[model samples]
Target: MVVKRLSALKRFLIGRPLKSNELGEQKLNKTKALAILSSDALSSVAYGPEQILIVLVTLSAAAFWYSIPIAVGVLVLLSALILSYRQIIFAYPHGGGAYVVSKENLGMNYGLVAGGSLLVDYILTVAVSVSAGTDAITSAFPSLHPYTVVIAIVFVLLITTLNLRGVTESASILAYPVYLFVLALFILIGVGIYNILTGHVSPELHTPVGTPVAGISLFLLLKAFASGSSALTGVEAISNAIPNFKDPAPNNASKTLMAMGTLLALLFTGIVFMAYYYGVAPQAKVTVVSQIAEQTFGRNFMYYFIQGTTALILILAANTGYSAFPLLAVNLAKDKFIPRMFTVRGDRLGYSNGIIILGVCSILLILVFKGQTEHLIPLYAVGVFIPFTLSQTGMIFKWVREKPSGWMPKLIINSIGALISLIVTIMFFLTKFAQVWPVLIFLPIIIYIFYRIKKHYLAVGDQLRLTTCEPAMPIEGNVIIVPVAGITHVVENSLNYAKSLNPHQVIAVYVPFERQEENDFEAKWMKWQPDVRLVTLYSPYRSIIQPLLKFVDTVQRKASESNYQVTVVIPQFIPKKGWHNILHNQSGLVIRTKLLYRRKVIVTTVPYHLTK
Candidate 1:
């Protein structure tokens, strides 16, 4: 049992022993997991419209107030989009995220592009959401502002460690927080709504800032759309996380999407309505939600409670990213579009390597934007929309390729869905290009590099293809070549061992350098093994690799001609300290690689463990 636990730990570090089943052992019914997924996306209500207001504030006074209508429009559009994805869930719910949809329909290349884009978006979701959450917390306690980035980072690290321990462990840990966030939103929004409906609604607006933006233009509307789309960011998380659901995965996934969609719409509507009721417009100077809280309860306990919840939810937002990115990485690896290491699971049976890489990237983003959601908002929407565009386009292709005659309902709905998503994607890119174009430019270069890597792996596989086996040949003679730098105990022990192998003959090959005062080693070898052969090759430029390689070739040619079995024993010293690895010794790999090409020759490393 102890050994099994130790082995499990080793595997966790390397990414094995998946914990999905462990989560199941707790028997979280489908409704529970669905609630977690729904709660994750639903929490965006705290900041989604605030993102829009940040951008629109750059325009006119009227544009500032336009956030209300825009938020309503976005909520409706997002609900429709969520409904569309329900079809996708039922159709391909074996964890076929956008990447799989795009790959199955469009092609592997596009799938990879979509996967990379979604990955970046999800990472941003975590960073931006958590940072925003931290902001909300700091608003409650102004003292924490200076350390907000540190707090955000700590949040990311905790989530990453939990995830690395296993998916089930992570889900179990996050379930209550997600539930608390949901319960908090319902209570707050519920009471806030009742207050609005009743004549008891009190007048509350922030201590007015400068005159708000007025007369918003088409471009301004587009920018608002881009920002508002952030609310829809984690909808795809459901697709990525479908695999984690209990059996009847598709039904569970569809129900989860529907539940999420309903809850998100209600939560966002409540928040938006309450913001308007309190006359809080989201501008760069005054984010709307903060104003609503200050108006509702002043700078007192209730205000602080909402602020604390915001911080908690934001920190938890990264949980959505943490869960999704690994699944996407798995999809990319399965397609042979990324490094094979991503395909492997770690000791906790989660993709720890991928998780860490994503966490680091997210932390960098949080720092770059100073944990400000407003600043990162522009870069945020482009990544999410890029994948949205590709996935919808792929679905169009999927519909076209299938050419289902009697399935006109499916065709018509998918076509409409595809057209709308594609147009939204393009609009977001056009509006957000200046703000986010650098990320767009950078991601493809990375995706292309991954493409090249896959190509190289395939090329090597093609080369190694075996056609026929060589007929067996009897060994006529045996030759041993012990590569020597200096006759240390390691070299002496290796030489002695090689001699004992009782080959047809033994020879010691040494590289002579001009600066070396190692004359004693050759003399010692000669004195000790007078009957053994010793060959020394001179390297004039002190270049060791070429001369040693040439001598080995010459010896191999002679051995092959005589049908000799040559065994080369290279003495290697394993350092006790890691830092000494480079300084103390080199050339172990170089020598081994060169000898690998020769046939009928066996190369062994007699490793000496260096003791402190």
Candidate 2:
């Protein structure tokens, strides 16, 4: 009944099992795909620019002046990645994520590097996005700050469950919030721009750019670019999920990628410019974006509206990782690089195992870091850049080799992208190595784990190989021995079934603790005078399994000489109510488990299901 109730809850939450024919119906069109797949990139703007100021504000007041340059660099790189991935969408056209691209062009080792990085990134994406979204909530209601970790974990759980309902359904559920967020942010930017032109500002608008700061250096500006790279983290999700798009999947995916890149660049640049103009700094608790909204829109409905939508979109951004991670896991599993269970489609046709794993990992990260977005950001940036570098470098090689129409220009563009990304990756780690060291330590370990999984898969496949279809020799005789505790209706039912097997003999074996009880059982057996023979044994040590093993070995030794096979049949009584099982000791389970490993002995169970 408990299992049935859980199953019903699952069906109610995720809908009914999707038939194979219904898979086509689950594909996303452009609008839904953009909302579902682009959430990560689109939502990153909420914190991406703030991350840059976080690094620069430590330098000096003048260091804030470099944010525009960093934003420009990010936008340029975003453009390159968009074009490079558009080529990838058409070139491979089956959702050519970095892992697939690197595996195909660079080799398996490089592919594993890309795959591992992405795995870490997607997990961190959920962690960081959830934490950041929760931060937005705390920004509005400061009293809720203590529950940040709890709220982030609950948000992850919700997104994980929603994704398990299948792709299209999740997209449809999330589209409205994403659209509302877009509308609210643009309105803030518009009204903020108007206020700036009119020379009117709120009292919250005045704040220092920096204090007690170090001088800005060339290295500091580069570090700022690395910090702002959070904006680019989710851009690869579209390439990973091309197959989820509607008819002409590649074209639709490429368009979605283009749309996402453009929006991300615009929002990231706008937020940074407005923060600078308004002198919004990194607060101890609230975000700079919140400060800007309050300064421009005041503490009115629009102010709360933007904060609410920001929180919604940031949580929805986690949906981007939710969509990509399972698909990447499935691709890796299909290639035998990961556990095959990752490839199993749930009742709703989603990669349910992968989704649940992603959720659990994100929850752990949230709890470990106490849902601090700043701490989570460095971890996200490091993982994201490695895959970004590999994917672009692979694309350059792909274009160079293929030399399709206009391949030279595409090659040149991806080459520039590869170089910039490689620089950012090196600089990102060098600047943020302290926070990223844990990930670096785990990457190779994860790679080795996947290798071990593949090895285990191959070893099992080898053992399961069949050399011949039928048995080499046939059994001359068969004996059925039923394991009995005492004479009961369950045991009697088992004995009758053993007799029906038409074996050479049917015997009931019992191991008793005391001679008095053995005698009493013997007397009862004699009085019953059933057709089966009763064999009794004594165990002074009170060990049932040891005595049973000895009896079985003796029977097998005698039977083997006559070319006979042995069968041990145990009767099991199953209670109707689940709690009733707790009322009874499971000796039947113990006997079956112990005798299963013996050679030349087959164990069969007869279940006597109780009506009451």
Candidate 3:
């Protein structure tokens, strides 16, 4: 009854499903269903061009102007890729993305590579898009400067929670706002361009933004392309979530891809044309959409509305990541590359663990960068293109192996995508070395480590399989050993905590770092009454682990004399903030590890919460 009431309350809070039966088949036609996926793809319009313009500012205005060609190239490539993915949906309707396609057609290693790249790309998409949105907000209101990343992170956490609740809930909540933003954007761009073309427009924020460089050099053009390519980041989300659509996955996917392409082209072209016509140099310091709006709308109500709408769009942009990332995690989990928690869905049928993980990671990124989108912009594209290049190549391989009846079209289209993505990736790499290279190396190393973990899990599972039900090991006494460093709350808590467990015997063992520390422990020992007796172990070398190990070993040896158990209670200070964690408790970790490996000992961690 409580569950049903909660479900009803949730439904009331979010909305009723698009279909009558909540768990039944979706009744949304291909067009309607396509809108949800397309929204994720199309929402890139909000910050995609902004990313390009921001990057081009590194060069002169003339070079920044060349962002036009880069935008056009990206749009063209986007169309080609959409067409290619259409073939992918048709070929693998069961929903095999880059990894599945690569593994089935190419090899296992290629598949793992694709999965790793995709996972990194998914994480980057969240960071970049949210950071970009935060930038737009900061641009409008300078007071929001330091808080942009904080706000963006809050939004990430909120969106992740919403997604964990369910996609249908999130879609219903976000769909209208996203569509409204797009509509508002299209109207603004369409009318603004028309006004500029008819010579009825005034100058923009960076009016007549001076060009430092003369002609667009090859390097300049490549940089522009790399920046503009950020617009194409979320295109694969539709393919990733193809299974979530209504009936006819292929048809829905194709229609969604087409809508996304059309919207993307219009958005990129419209924004570029507006900025170009008004001489809004791509490499200017006019940070916010408000500045851009003031240039056009001239500090009117429309300006405020535009700023508000941009914020709305940017916040929802994280929603794209929230929805898509969980699916990627689920895919990786299925392949046993990620932990199985990602595969478990909530009562609402959403990947809850995956959502929380993405939220926390994105929040950390936003906090670390202090919500400054400009600084993070450089690192963004690196993670995006890494997977894009690998995925496109994987598709080509998939096309080759499963040479379907009409494989020619897919072959040619995916071939173009692969070639373009490869070139763009190279361009981005060359353009973004100082800022982005570290991320490129770091993400892959982390991914490879996860792969190793997967391998180890599988190997260990097989090795540790219990062949037969052996007799239960006899209790070796409940002798509790209290690991003490000094007489802090951590130590007292450990003493009280071990006593609370009601063990057979509790002995407080202290590693004397200095005479003062030993003296302090003795002074504080009588302040509280614990059932355990205290013992001081001297360390001549000021070593923590060795002394703790020797004490635990002595207890273990004594335990054999009388079938008693030994439980080592290590007192640890848990800091409220991460910075505090770095400073405190270096000795506790070492002691805990040493005590854990003893033959017949149980390790208990008694953590006392401490303020920074």
Candidate 4:
């Protein structure tokens, strides 16, 4: 009854389970796919521009203008990544992304490294995105500042629940918020640009004057570039999740990738350009986008609307991680790098285990970092860029080895991407070494765990393989032992079942805590004359299961020496009420657990239902 209620509650939460045939229907079209897959990249515009100014602002107020060129640099890298991933989509449509590309071309260790990095990045994506979303909210309403961690965790759980409901369902629900954010940003950028071009708003009005604290150097520019490169964090997600697209999956996924890249470039460029024109600096609580909106629209409905949509899209950005993490985990699980449970689809045909795991990890990160985006930002880009480099390099290897038609141009694009990504990775390590070192430490540990999991699965495969094994043979003899607490209907039922086994001998064993009870039990057994041999082993310390286990071990050893199998039958009474279970001891459960690994010993249970 409790199981039924719990199952009903699950159905209510995630909706009815879809049949296997409905899986194709769950494949997403380009629009919904854009919402589900591209949201992380799209929503990065909310904070990506600000991350640049955060670094540049440290130099001087004049350093703010440098954001324009840095944004341009990031856009150039974005183009290369888009082109390279488009080729990746066509080349490897089955969609393990870097892990598949690297494994097939570069080897298993490289593949594990790429897979582990992406998994870490996906987790950080959830943490950073949700935390950033909460920041937007706290910016809008200072009253919620104290609950940032709670709010971030709530958003993580919300996205996780949406994903668990199934891909198509989540896509449908999240599609509007993403489009709303895009629309809001387009309006903000257009109005802000128009106001600037006309004499309505002066850029000089908002510009600040201050002495330079540090001179602008190549290293500083690279640091700013590395920070802003987080905008490209979700670019590879489309390639990772090509299988989630509708039929002609590769074509659809590629189209989505182009659409995402185009929108991201436009939004990122507009925001950064306006942020420069407006002379907005990163505030302790307010976001750069929020500042731009307020400067342009003066805290009107449009201002709140932009903030609301930004928060929504930022929260929804976690959908990309939700979409890609599970699919990537499924691929890893199929290859035996992770647990096989991640490969199993839930009732809604989603990788529920992977989604839940990602949610838990993200929540822990939010808690540990107190939902601060700045703290998480350093860990984010390095994880993503490592995979970006590995994936692009893997593509280079693919083209050189496969040398398919037009492989030269493809190789060139991926080469540029690989080189740029490698440089950015090195820059992240050098610039953010203090904050990003933990990622370096974590990557090796995760890769080691992957190899360990692979080894275990391989060992299990070897043990369970049937091709080289001999056929089974019938048992020469059987000895059955029944353990009883006292003579009752439960014990009688077990003895009846034991007699039905047609064993060579049936012996009933009992452990008595006191001599009086042993004498009374033996007298009762003799009076009943049940025809089955009865034995009682006295316990000195009032132990029950210990003596019974010792005797069973002895019986099994003798049976094994005689080429006979031993089966131990245990009698248990099932109480009518669920809470009634606590009224009885779990000796049967304990014995079963303890003897589970003993070879040639079979344990069976005879259950008698209780009326009262």
Per-candidate Cα lDDT values, in order, are 0.72, 0.87, 0.69, 0.90
Off by over 4 Å in 1: 1-28, 199-214, 283-287, 367-370, 400-406, 467-478, 500-502, 512-519, 539-543, 557-567, 575-583, 587-603, 610-612
Q: After TM-score superposition, what is the CA distance of residue 92 in candidate 1 from its true location, in Å? A: 1.0
- lDDT comparing candidate 3 with the true structure: 0.69
TM-score list, all predictions? 0.86, 0.93, 0.73, 0.96
Clashes of 4: 0
Writing each residue's lDDT as its tens digit, candidate 2 over 1-612 gives 887998899888888998978889989999999999898888999999998998888865456767877888998889988888887888777774999989988888889999998988899999988899999999999999989988998899899989989998899989999989888888888887788788775524433444233576788888999899878889889999998999899989988889888788778878998887787788878888899999887899988999999999999899988899999999889888898999998898888999999999999989889999898888898788888889888887787777788789888878888888899888878898888888778889989988998888887877667753334457887888898887789988998899889534987888889999999998898777466788988999998888888899899999889888899999999998888999998988998998999968999999999998
Q: How well is each residue in 196-257 modelled by candidate 4, as lDDT tens digits?
A: 88978875744443324457789998989999998888999999999899999999999999
Candidate 1, residues 1-612, lDDT tens digits: the string is 455776776566444454555545532345666544654476678888676766665664345556667777787667656766776787677775788888888887788778878878878887887777787777666787789889888887777777676666666667776667767677777777776678556644422333344565777776676677677778878877777777777787788788788878887877766765665566433446667777666777766666666667767777778777887888777767777788776656567778888889989988887888766756776677667677766766776778666555666666665665666677766776677777768787978887898898888777676654345678886788888877588877887788888644778877777524446656777787677677877777887778877887788888888888778888898777766777865787788888788766688998888897
Report RMSD (Å) for each prediction in the order shown: 4.4, 2.9, 8.0, 2.2
Worst 10 residues of 2 by lDDT: 203-212
Pairs in steric clash, model 2: none
What's the true lDDT of residue 315 in model 1?
76
Q: How does model 4 fare in lDDT?
A: 0.90
lDDT leader:
4
Global CA lDDT of candidate 2, please?
A: 0.87
Error of 1 at 341 (Å): 1.9
Highest-TM-score candidate: 4
